[model samples]
Target: MFTLKTATSFEETIKKSLFICHATPITSAEEALAFFQTYHQADATHNCWAFKLTQSYRFNDDGEPGGTAGRPILQAIEGQELVNVAVLVIRYFGGIKLGTGGLVRAYGGTAAKCLHQAEKEKIIPTTLIRCTATFSEMAMVKSRLWQEGVQLISEDFTENGVCWILSIPDEQLDVLSAVYTNITRGRIFEKIET
Candidate 1:
């Protein structure tokens, strides 16, 4: 529902190997995969990645193990209640083999650290509608909706009157429609919720 406005990174040492985690918010899994491929290095020993968007999710251990690397990283992301985000943990082997537990710590810890440092934002559900009003009723009609918490997206003046496009919270749809009618004495325009 929400996405980060910027990318962030973090680093850590695990069993002598340097694990660097790069995280960014993305609206879909396709974007996340594209970002991972773009930043994935041929020289890094492993580039494990994970992403969660609502009920959909995916993770890649990248040959590390069955579930040690990517799954734990996903857990870290979910633990923080993040959505529409991806975290790629790149590990540079320092001549040490980190067992399953160590790999989990390396990848999961790096993701947690990176996401913790990144900026987070909340998503609000909204409905977009076009409310038309007569030229004479424009101002009052618009004013009433604004006072009722409807966000005005834009307005247009035409031969018929002034048409206002606005976004209101989904829950307020019926109320907004009813109030607009009463406020304009049935002169306001129709509404299309999107």
Candidate 2:
């Protein structure tokens, strides 16, 4: 799955109605709700939204026809194979009334355009590792791990050395373990279970 690199938005006037879509990368349902609340326009005719997560998804058409606004927006997100993302499409009635089909096209098209233009990155699987290094090996271990693209989540200094918590790409586990072993001469290296 992929997610937006950053929050992005698109605005266009379709059939005299203005549609504004804001897409944001989200980690949780709460974050999605917060984004919706923060971006919803009160004076606008409708503030439709949708969110896709790893475990769940939701959509709201606001006041538009049951499926015209929200479902199309969700489909747009899924069409892009996106997860952990939220999209909010705000509408300001432009004197002209667009039928159901027009509403769906405007909302979905705007969201799709916004997402297509935004930069995105892949989500790689990661493994958490906990290890300890001796005082003499601490600096070398940390530096080498960083060089290998390991995320050093935390480091707790202890009398003997430093306790390290690292986030390593799953594919690099074996290589990273070998590097850690070589640096610390087979010191304490353990996988942390979530």
Candidate 3:
């Protein structure tokens, strides 16, 4: 439930050539690769890139060297604990030379700094559920649920009292179930989410 709010791009000069790194949070591997392809300048001397999604990803030096460019950048991404993200580092040679190892450190270091500058946000998931309880138990249930941040989305009054629709966090289900039992003396029923 964590993700970056925006894509960030940064530019730096390493050994004369300008290095531009674009870092964006992506949900899938395909999206990551597509981003690299879309933004890469074909005429550039090198367009090295790295991406990671969950536990799987790949990086390519794009002819820089065996491990001097891509692998290090990918490591930097993982080291930052970033997920669903891609880093495309485009290098335009300035007719100067940085050894293969220098290129790796430059690409990865620049990308890591870009990500460090980006903002991160948390996304809390909510689920819909049906809850039923007797009339006498309504007050207690309502109070406890409100305290727990459960939203009473809607309700249907019936002979048995009220059937309510609510939104709750997944992690709070067990505690919420206990609250329902204490309120309705086990008369309450909550439908499990599929």
Could you estimate the TM-score for every candidate?
Answer: 0.82, 0.82, 0.70
How far does residue 134 in candidate 1 sit from its true spot (Å)? Answer: 2.1
Clash count, candidate 3:
0
Compute the lDDT of residue 178 as modeled in candidate 1.
Answer: 86
Candidate 2 lDDT by residue in tens digits, 15-51? 7888999999999999999999999899999999999
- Candidate 2 Cα RMSD after full superposition onto the native fold (Å): 2.7
Candidate with top lDDT is 2
137, model 2: CA deviation in Å? 5.3
When superposed on Cα atoms, how far off is each prediction in RMSD? 2.9, 2.7, 4.3
lDDT of 3 at 14: 85
Residue pairs in steric clash, candidate 3? none
Going through the candidates in order, what is the number of backbone clashes in each? 1, 0, 0
User: Order the candidates by lDDT, highest first — what do you get?
Assistant: 2, 1, 3
Task: Enumerate residue pairs that collide in model 1.
Answer: 132-189
For model 3, where is the 10-residue window of minimal lDDT? 185-194
lDDT of 1 at 22: 90
lDDT of each residue in 38-155, candidate 3, tens digit only: 9999998889998887668899999997898889888887787777788998889998788877887888898888888888766455667788767887777777776565777889
Residue range 51-152, candidate 1, lDDT tens digits: 988769999999998999999999998888888889999999999888888788778888998988888887666778887888787777767677555687
